[model samples]
Target: MNSLSNQSRVTYSGTGRRKSSIARVRLIPGSGKLIINGLPGESYLQFSPNYLRISYAPLRTLGLSTEYDIHVKTKGGGLTGQADAIRLGIARALCNINPENRSTLKSEGYLTRDPRVKERRKYGLRKARKAPQYSKR
Candidate 1:
Protein backbone atom coordinates (compact mmCIF):
# COMPACT_ATOMS: atom_id res chain seq x y z
CA MET A 1 0.00 0.00 0.00
CA ASN A 2 1.05 3.68 0.07
CA SER A 3 2.34 3.41 3.63
CA LEU A 4 4.71 0.56 2.83
CA SER A 5 5.96 2.36 -0.25
CA ASN A 6 6.48 5.52 1.72
CA GLN A 7 8.50 3.79 4.40
CA SER A 8 10.71 2.11 1.85
CA ARG A 9 11.50 5.36 0.10
CA VAL A 10 12.63 7.18 3.20
CA THR A 11 16.22 8.41 3.26
CA TYR A 12 17.83 11.13 5.30
CA SER A 13 20.91 13.14 6.23
CA GLY A 14 21.64 14.45 9.72
CA THR A 15 24.26 15.90 12.01
CA GLY A 16 25.22 14.49 15.41
CA ARG A 17 26.81 16.21 18.38
CA ARG A 18 28.48 14.89 21.55
CA LYS A 19 30.98 16.51 23.85
CA SER A 20 33.17 18.60 21.51
CA SER A 21 32.79 16.26 18.55
CA ILE A 22 30.41 16.41 15.62
CA ALA A 23 29.50 13.95 12.89
CA ARG A 24 27.63 14.37 9.62
CA VAL A 25 25.74 11.26 8.62
CA ARG A 26 23.79 10.12 5.59
CA LEU A 27 21.36 7.25 5.68
CA ILE A 28 20.39 5.18 2.64
CA PRO A 29 18.72 1.85 2.17
CA GLY A 30 21.26 -0.92 1.77
CA SER A 31 22.92 -3.78 3.59
CA GLY A 32 24.23 -2.67 6.98
CA LYS A 33 27.71 -1.38 6.27
CA LEU A 34 29.27 1.66 7.91
CA ILE A 35 31.61 3.90 5.99
CA ILE A 36 33.65 6.63 7.62
CA ASN A 37 34.93 9.23 5.24
CA GLY A 38 35.01 6.75 2.38
CA LEU A 39 36.79 4.03 4.36
CA PRO A 40 35.31 0.59 4.74
CA GLY A 41 33.83 -0.92 7.88
CA GLU A 42 37.09 -2.57 8.93
CA SER A 43 38.77 0.79 9.34
CA TYR A 44 36.65 1.58 12.38
CA LEU A 45 38.42 -1.24 14.21
CA GLN A 46 41.23 1.23 14.83
CA PHE A 47 38.85 2.73 17.36
CA SER A 48 37.65 0.86 20.44
CA PRO A 49 34.82 -1.65 19.99
CA ASN A 50 32.91 -0.03 22.83
CA TYR A 51 32.93 3.22 20.94
CA LEU A 52 31.69 1.63 17.76
CA ARG A 53 28.96 -0.25 19.63
CA ILE A 54 27.69 2.86 21.35
CA SER A 55 27.45 4.61 18.00
CA TYR A 56 25.60 1.74 16.36
CA ALA A 57 23.27 0.73 19.19
CA PRO A 58 20.41 2.94 18.10
CA LEU A 59 20.34 1.48 14.62
CA ARG A 60 20.11 -2.02 15.96
CA THR A 61 17.50 -1.06 18.51
CA LEU A 62 15.34 0.22 15.68
CA GLY A 63 15.36 -3.31 14.21
CA LEU A 64 16.77 -1.98 11.00
CA SER A 65 19.21 -4.87 10.79
CA THR A 66 21.09 -5.21 7.50
CA GLU A 67 18.96 -2.71 5.69
CA TYR A 68 20.63 0.67 5.95
CA ASP A 69 23.97 2.08 4.87
CA ILE A 70 25.59 4.79 6.96
CA HIS A 71 28.20 7.24 5.84
CA VAL A 72 29.80 9.61 8.32
CA LYS A 73 32.50 12.23 8.68
CA THR A 74 33.39 12.86 12.32
CA LYS A 75 35.98 15.05 13.95
CA GLY A 76 36.91 17.30 16.93
CA GLY A 77 37.09 14.76 19.75
CA GLY A 78 38.61 11.56 21.02
CA LEU A 79 37.34 8.17 19.87
CA THR A 80 34.70 7.89 22.60
CA GLY A 81 33.47 11.38 21.91
CA GLN A 82 33.35 10.70 18.19
CA ALA A 83 31.30 7.57 18.77
CA ASP A 84 28.75 9.42 20.87
CA ALA A 85 28.53 12.06 18.19
CA ILE A 86 27.89 9.47 15.53
CA ARG A 87 25.19 7.91 17.71
CA LEU A 88 23.39 11.23 17.88
CA GLY A 89 23.64 11.64 14.11
CA ILE A 90 22.13 8.23 13.43
CA ALA A 91 19.31 8.87 15.91
CA ARG A 92 18.48 12.10 14.17
CA ALA A 93 18.54 10.42 10.77
CA LEU A 94 16.15 7.76 12.01
CA CYS A 95 13.84 10.41 13.37
CA ASN A 96 13.78 12.03 9.96
CA ILE A 97 12.85 8.76 8.35
CA ASN A 98 9.84 8.48 10.64
CA PRO A 99 8.94 11.42 12.81
CA GLU A 100 6.49 9.30 14.77
CA ASN A 101 9.42 7.51 16.38
CA ARG A 102 10.82 10.67 17.93
CA SER A 103 9.15 10.00 21.27
CA THR A 104 10.71 6.55 21.49
CA LEU A 105 14.19 7.84 20.67
CA LYS A 106 13.76 10.81 22.99
CA SER A 107 12.79 8.57 25.88
CA GLU A 108 16.00 6.61 25.32
CA GLY A 109 18.02 9.83 25.58
CA TYR A 110 19.50 9.52 22.13
CA LEU A 111 18.50 13.03 21.06
CA THR A 112 20.50 14.86 23.72
CA ARG A 113 24.21 15.52 23.39
CA ASP A 114 26.34 15.07 26.50
CA PRO A 115 28.16 18.29 27.37
CA ARG A 116 30.95 17.32 29.77
CA VAL A 117 34.69 17.17 29.37
CA LYS A 118 37.88 17.26 31.47
CA GLU A 119 38.94 20.68 32.63
CA ARG A 120 42.39 22.00 31.74
CA ARG A 121 45.06 21.52 34.40
CA LYS A 122 46.06 24.69 36.23
CA TYR A 123 49.61 26.07 35.97
CA GLY A 124 52.28 25.06 38.56
CA LEU A 125 50.59 21.89 39.78
CA ARG A 126 51.82 18.33 39.73
CA LYS A 127 48.44 17.01 38.65
CA ALA A 128 45.55 19.48 38.28
CA ARG A 129 46.45 20.72 41.83
CA LYS A 130 48.50 18.05 43.57
CA ALA A 131 50.98 20.77 44.67
CA PRO A 132 53.84 18.28 44.47
CA GLN A 133 54.89 16.49 47.68
CA TYR A 134 54.77 19.15 50.40
CA SER A 135 57.00 18.48 53.41
CA LYS A 136 57.70 21.19 56.06
CA ARG A 137 59.59 19.84 59.04
Candidate 2:
Protein backbone atom coordinates (compact mmCIF):
# COMPACT_ATOMS: atom_id res chain seq x y z
CA MET A 1 0.00 0.00 0.00
CA ASN A 2 1.06 3.62 -0.67
CA SER A 3 1.74 6.11 2.11
CA LEU A 4 -0.66 9.02 2.78
CA SER A 5 2.27 11.43 2.42
CA ASN A 6 2.42 10.68 -1.27
CA GLN A 7 -0.55 12.93 -1.96
CA SER A 8 -0.30 16.68 -2.38
CA ARG A 9 -2.19 18.90 0.04
CA VAL A 10 -4.28 21.87 -1.05
CA THR A 11 -6.66 24.08 0.86
CA TYR A 12 -9.21 26.72 -0.09
CA SER A 13 -10.29 29.44 2.27
CA GLY A 14 -12.95 32.16 2.44
CA THR A 15 -14.60 34.55 4.86
CA GLY A 16 -18.27 35.19 5.42
CA ARG A 17 -20.31 37.52 7.57
CA ARG A 18 -23.87 38.08 8.71
CA LYS A 19 -25.12 40.66 11.13
CA SER A 20 -22.46 40.81 13.87
CA SER A 21 -21.01 37.38 13.17
CA ILE A 22 -18.06 36.41 11.02
CA ALA A 23 -16.77 33.04 9.90
CA ARG A 24 -13.52 31.96 8.36
CA VAL A 25 -13.74 28.68 6.45
CA ARG A 26 -11.25 26.34 4.91
CA LEU A 27 -11.86 23.47 2.53
CA ILE A 28 -9.66 20.52 1.78
CA PRO A 29 -10.09 17.45 -0.34
CA GLY A 30 -11.24 14.56 1.84
CA SER A 31 -14.25 12.64 3.01
CA GLY A 32 -17.16 14.79 4.10
CA LYS A 33 -16.44 16.34 7.48
CA LEU A 34 -17.27 19.64 9.09
CA ILE A 35 -15.47 21.09 12.07
CA ILE A 36 -16.44 24.38 13.64
CA ASN A 37 -14.63 25.99 16.52
CA GLY A 38 -12.88 22.65 17.06
CA LEU A 39 -16.16 20.77 17.38
CA PRO A 40 -17.97 18.62 14.89
CA GLY A 41 -20.82 20.36 13.14
CA GLU A 42 -23.51 18.07 14.46
CA SER A 43 -22.18 18.29 18.01
CA TYR A 44 -21.72 22.03 18.04
CA LEU A 45 -25.07 22.70 16.41
CA GLN A 46 -27.07 19.87 17.95
CA PHE A 47 -29.24 22.37 19.71
CA SER A 48 -30.72 23.35 16.34
CA PRO A 49 -31.00 20.97 13.45
CA ASN A 50 -31.99 23.82 11.15
CA TYR A 51 -28.59 25.36 11.75
CA LEU A 52 -26.92 22.15 10.69
CA ARG A 53 -28.91 22.19 7.47
CA ILE A 54 -28.19 25.85 6.85
CA SER A 55 -24.45 25.39 7.31
CA TYR A 56 -24.31 22.47 4.89
CA ALA A 57 -26.77 23.78 2.32
CA PRO A 58 -24.08 25.14 0.05
CA LEU A 59 -22.30 21.85 -0.28
CA ARG A 60 -25.56 20.06 -0.85
CA THR A 61 -26.52 22.56 -3.50
CA LEU A 62 -23.39 21.82 -5.47
CA GLY A 63 -23.55 18.07 -4.84
CA LEU A 64 -20.15 18.32 -3.18
CA SER A 65 -21.03 17.41 0.36
CA THR A 66 -18.85 14.34 0.25
CA GLU A 67 -16.01 15.65 -1.87
CA TYR A 68 -14.51 18.08 0.61
CA ASP A 69 -13.88 18.55 4.29
CA ILE A 70 -14.88 21.83 5.90
CA HIS A 71 -13.27 23.67 8.79
CA VAL A 72 -14.70 26.85 10.21
CA LYS A 73 -13.86 29.43 12.86
CA THR A 74 -16.69 31.76 13.75
CA LYS A 75 -17.25 34.53 16.27
CA GLY A 76 -19.85 37.11 17.30
CA GLY A 77 -23.64 36.94 17.00
CA GLY A 78 -25.69 33.88 17.92
CA LEU A 79 -25.65 30.32 16.64
CA THR A 80 -28.09 31.07 13.81
CA GLY A 81 -26.01 33.93 12.48
CA GLN A 82 -22.82 31.93 12.80
CA ALA A 83 -24.38 29.08 10.87
CA ASP A 84 -25.42 31.35 8.02
CA ALA A 85 -21.99 32.92 7.95
CA ILE A 86 -20.36 29.52 7.67
CA ARG A 87 -22.66 28.63 4.79
CA LEU A 88 -21.60 31.66 2.81
CA GLY A 89 -17.96 31.04 3.64
CA ILE A 90 -18.18 27.52 2.31
CA ALA A 91 -19.85 28.74 -0.87
CA ARG A 92 -17.06 31.25 -1.37
CA ALA A 93 -14.36 28.63 -0.92
CA LEU A 94 -16.09 26.44 -3.47
CA CYS A 95 -16.13 29.34 -5.87
CA ASN A 96 -12.41 29.78 -5.40
CA ILE A 97 -11.96 26.27 -6.70
CA ASN A 98 -13.95 27.09 -9.82
CA PRO A 99 -15.05 30.53 -10.89
CA GLU A 100 -17.76 28.93 -12.98
CA ASN A 101 -19.53 27.86 -9.83
CA ARG A 102 -20.14 31.46 -8.83
CA SER A 103 -23.17 31.83 -11.06
CA THR A 104 -24.73 28.66 -9.74
CA LEU A 105 -24.03 29.55 -6.13
CA LYS A 106 -25.23 33.08 -6.71
CA SER A 107 -28.41 31.79 -8.25
CA GLU A 108 -29.00 29.76 -5.13
CA GLY A 109 -28.46 32.93 -3.06
CA TYR A 110 -25.63 31.38 -1.10
CA LEU A 111 -22.97 33.81 -2.28
CA THR A 112 -24.65 36.94 -1.02
CA ARG A 113 -23.64 38.32 2.37
CA ASP A 114 -26.63 39.13 4.52
CA PRO A 115 -26.66 42.88 5.18
CA ARG A 116 -29.22 42.99 7.98
CA VAL A 117 -27.88 44.27 11.30
CA LYS A 118 -29.17 45.46 14.62
CA GLU A 119 -30.25 49.09 14.67
CA ARG A 120 -28.66 51.43 17.16
CA ARG A 121 -30.81 52.88 19.93
CA LYS A 122 -31.72 56.53 19.71
CA TYR A 123 -31.07 58.88 22.61
CA GLY A 124 -34.76 59.62 23.13
CA LEU A 125 -36.24 56.27 22.17
CA ARG A 126 -36.38 53.16 24.32
CA LYS A 127 -34.88 51.16 21.49
CA ALA A 128 -34.07 51.67 17.81
CA ARG A 129 -37.66 52.63 17.09
CA LYS A 130 -39.68 52.00 20.19
CA ALA A 131 -40.70 55.27 21.76
CA PRO A 132 -41.38 55.89 25.45
CA GLN A 133 -44.99 55.70 26.66
CA TYR A 134 -46.85 58.79 25.54
CA SER A 135 -48.74 60.63 28.30
CA LYS A 136 -51.33 63.37 28.07
CA ARG A 137 -52.85 65.00 31.10
Candidate 3:
Protein backbone atom coordinates (compact mmCIF):
# COMPACT_ATOMS: atom_id res chain seq x y z
CA MET A 1 0.00 0.00 0.00
CA ASN A 2 2.99 2.26 0.28
CA SER A 3 3.15 2.58 -3.46
CA LEU A 4 -0.51 3.47 -3.60
CA SER A 5 -0.10 6.11 -0.93
CA ASN A 6 2.94 7.57 -2.68
CA GLN A 7 0.97 7.85 -5.90
CA SER A 8 -1.62 9.97 -4.13
CA ARG A 9 0.79 12.70 -3.16
CA VAL A 10 -0.08 15.51 -5.49
CA THR A 11 1.06 19.10 -5.41
CA TYR A 12 -0.76 22.07 -6.85
CA SER A 13 0.46 25.62 -7.26
CA GLY A 14 -1.11 28.97 -8.07
CA THR A 15 -0.23 32.63 -8.18
CA GLY A 16 -2.33 35.36 -6.58
CA ARG A 17 -2.23 39.12 -6.53
CA ARG A 18 -3.84 41.85 -4.46
CA LYS A 19 -3.02 45.55 -4.54
CA SER A 20 0.79 45.49 -4.91
CA SER A 21 1.31 42.17 -3.21
CA ILE A 22 1.96 38.93 -5.01
CA ALA A 23 1.96 35.44 -3.61
CA ARG A 24 3.02 32.07 -4.88
CA VAL A 25 1.23 29.30 -3.06
CA ARG A 26 1.38 25.54 -3.11
CA LEU A 27 -0.92 22.90 -1.80
CA ILE A 28 0.13 19.41 -0.90
CA PRO A 29 -1.70 16.48 0.55
CA GLY A 30 -0.97 16.70 4.24
CA SER A 31 -2.53 17.49 7.55
CA GLY A 32 -3.61 21.13 7.61
CA LYS A 33 -0.18 22.63 8.02
CA LEU A 34 0.38 26.22 6.91
CA ILE A 35 3.78 27.75 6.40
CA ILE A 36 4.32 31.30 5.23
CA ASN A 37 7.72 32.57 4.23
CA GLY A 38 9.52 30.06 6.52
CA LEU A 39 7.29 30.84 9.49
CA PRO A 40 4.05 29.37 10.69
CA GLY A 41 0.91 31.05 9.37
CA GLU A 42 -0.34 32.33 12.71
CA SER A 43 3.07 33.62 13.70
CA TYR A 44 3.63 35.37 10.42
CA LEU A 45 0.25 37.09 10.67
CA GLN A 46 0.42 37.81 14.38
CA PHE A 47 -1.97 40.34 15.91
CA SER A 48 -4.20 40.29 12.87
CA PRO A 49 -7.17 38.02 13.25
CA ASN A 50 -8.71 39.38 10.06
CA TYR A 51 -5.64 38.56 8.05
CA LEU A 52 -5.58 35.05 9.38
CA ARG A 53 -9.26 34.66 8.59
CA ILE A 54 -8.81 35.87 5.04
CA SER A 55 -5.96 33.45 4.41
CA TYR A 56 -8.02 30.46 5.46
CA ALA A 57 -11.42 31.49 4.13
CA PRO A 58 -11.23 29.44 0.96
CA LEU A 59 -10.32 26.24 2.72
CA ARG A 60 -12.98 26.80 5.31
CA THR A 61 -15.58 27.37 2.61
CA LEU A 62 -14.78 24.01 1.09
CA GLY A 63 -14.60 22.17 4.39
CA LEU A 64 -11.04 21.20 3.55
CA SER A 65 -9.35 23.29 6.18
CA THR A 66 -7.74 20.20 7.67
CA GLU A 67 -7.19 18.14 4.55
CA TYR A 68 -4.27 19.88 2.82
CA ASP A 69 -1.16 21.77 3.69
CA ILE A 70 -0.41 25.26 2.39
CA HIS A 71 2.96 26.83 1.73
CA VAL A 72 3.25 30.44 0.63
CA LYS A 73 5.92 32.88 -0.45
CA THR A 74 4.72 36.43 -0.81
CA LYS A 75 6.13 39.92 -1.20
CA GLY A 76 5.09 43.54 -1.69
CA GLY A 77 2.18 45.46 -0.15
CA GLY A 78 1.17 45.16 3.51
CA LEU A 79 -0.26 42.43 5.70
CA THR A 80 -3.80 42.77 4.35
CA GLY A 81 -2.70 42.46 0.75
CA GLN A 82 -0.56 39.45 1.49
CA ALA A 83 -3.41 37.73 3.29
CA ASP A 84 -5.85 38.39 0.46
CA ALA A 85 -3.34 37.25 -2.12
CA ILE A 86 -2.79 34.03 -0.23
CA ARG A 87 -6.52 33.45 -0.06
CA LEU A 88 -6.90 33.81 -3.80
CA GLY A 89 -3.91 31.53 -4.34
CA ILE A 90 -5.45 28.85 -2.19
CA ALA A 91 -8.74 29.11 -4.06
CA ARG A 92 -7.01 28.78 -7.40
CA ALA A 93 -5.01 25.81 -6.18
CA LEU A 94 -8.20 24.16 -5.04
CA CYS A 95 -9.67 24.63 -8.49
CA ASN A 96 -6.59 22.95 -9.91
CA ILE A 97 -7.19 20.05 -7.57
CA ASN A 98 -10.78 19.77 -8.75
CA PRO A 99 -12.28 21.92 -11.46
CA GLU A 100 -15.68 21.56 -9.87
CA ASN A 101 -14.55 23.90 -7.14
CA ARG A 102 -14.40 26.76 -9.59
CA SER A 103 -18.09 27.65 -9.50
CA THR A 104 -18.27 27.57 -5.74
CA LEU A 105 -15.15 29.64 -5.28
CA LYS A 106 -16.24 32.02 -7.98
CA SER A 107 -19.63 32.51 -6.42
CA GLU A 108 -18.05 33.25 -3.09
CA GLY A 109 -15.68 35.77 -4.68
CA TYR A 110 -12.56 33.95 -3.55
CA LEU A 111 -11.29 33.32 -7.07
CA THR A 112 -11.62 36.92 -8.11
CA ARG A 113 -8.40 38.92 -8.11
CA ASP A 114 -9.01 42.21 -6.30
CA PRO A 115 -8.16 44.86 -8.86
CA ARG A 116 -7.98 47.82 -6.52
CA VAL A 117 -4.42 49.06 -6.03
CA LYS A 118 -2.61 52.03 -4.65
CA GLU A 119 -3.09 55.08 -6.82
CA ARG A 120 -0.10 56.83 -8.29
CA ARG A 121 1.11 60.03 -6.68
CA LYS A 122 0.73 62.99 -8.97
CA TYR A 123 3.85 65.06 -9.62
CA GLY A 124 2.78 68.07 -7.52
CA LEU A 125 0.65 66.32 -4.92
CA ARG A 126 1.74 65.52 -1.38
CA LYS A 127 0.00 62.20 -1.69
CA ALA A 128 -2.08 60.33 -4.25
CA ARG A 129 -4.77 62.97 -4.29
CA LYS A 130 -3.83 65.39 -1.54
CA ALA A 131 -2.15 68.62 -2.51
CA PRO A 132 0.10 70.86 -0.42
CA GLN A 133 -1.67 73.53 1.65
CA TYR A 134 -3.26 76.08 -0.64
CA SER A 135 -1.95 79.66 -0.59
CA LYS A 136 -4.84 82.11 -1.12
CA ARG A 137 -2.90 85.31 -0.47
lDDT of 1 at 90: 93
| Backbone clashes (count) for model 1 | 0
Query: Cα deviation of 118 in candidate 3 (Å)?
Result: 0.8
What value does the lDDT take at residue 18 in candidate 1? Answer: 74
lDDT of 2 at 19: 90
The ten-residue window of minimal lDDT in model 1 covers 40-49
* lDDT (0 to 1) per candidate: 0.82, 0.92, 0.94
- Measured with C-alpha atoms, the lDDT of residue 102 in candidate 3 is 94
lDDT of 3 by residue, 1-137 (tens): 99998788889999999999999999998899889999999999985889988999999999999999999999999898999999999999999999999999999999999899889999999999999999999
Clashing pairs in 2: none
Candidate 1 residues lying further than 4 Å off, grouped into runs, are 1-11, 124-137
**Whose TM-score is higher: candidate 2's or candidate 3's?**
2
Q: What is the lDDT of residue 92 in candidate 1?
A: 93
How far residue 36's Cα lies from its native spot in candidate 1, in Å, is 0.8
Task: State the local distance difference test value for candidate 1.
Answer: 0.82
Q: Is candidate 1 or candidate 3 better by TM-score?
A: 3
- TM-score for each prediction? 0.77, 0.92, 0.91
Rank by lDDT (best first): 3, 2, 1
Instruction: Name every residue pair that clashes in candidate 3.
Output: none
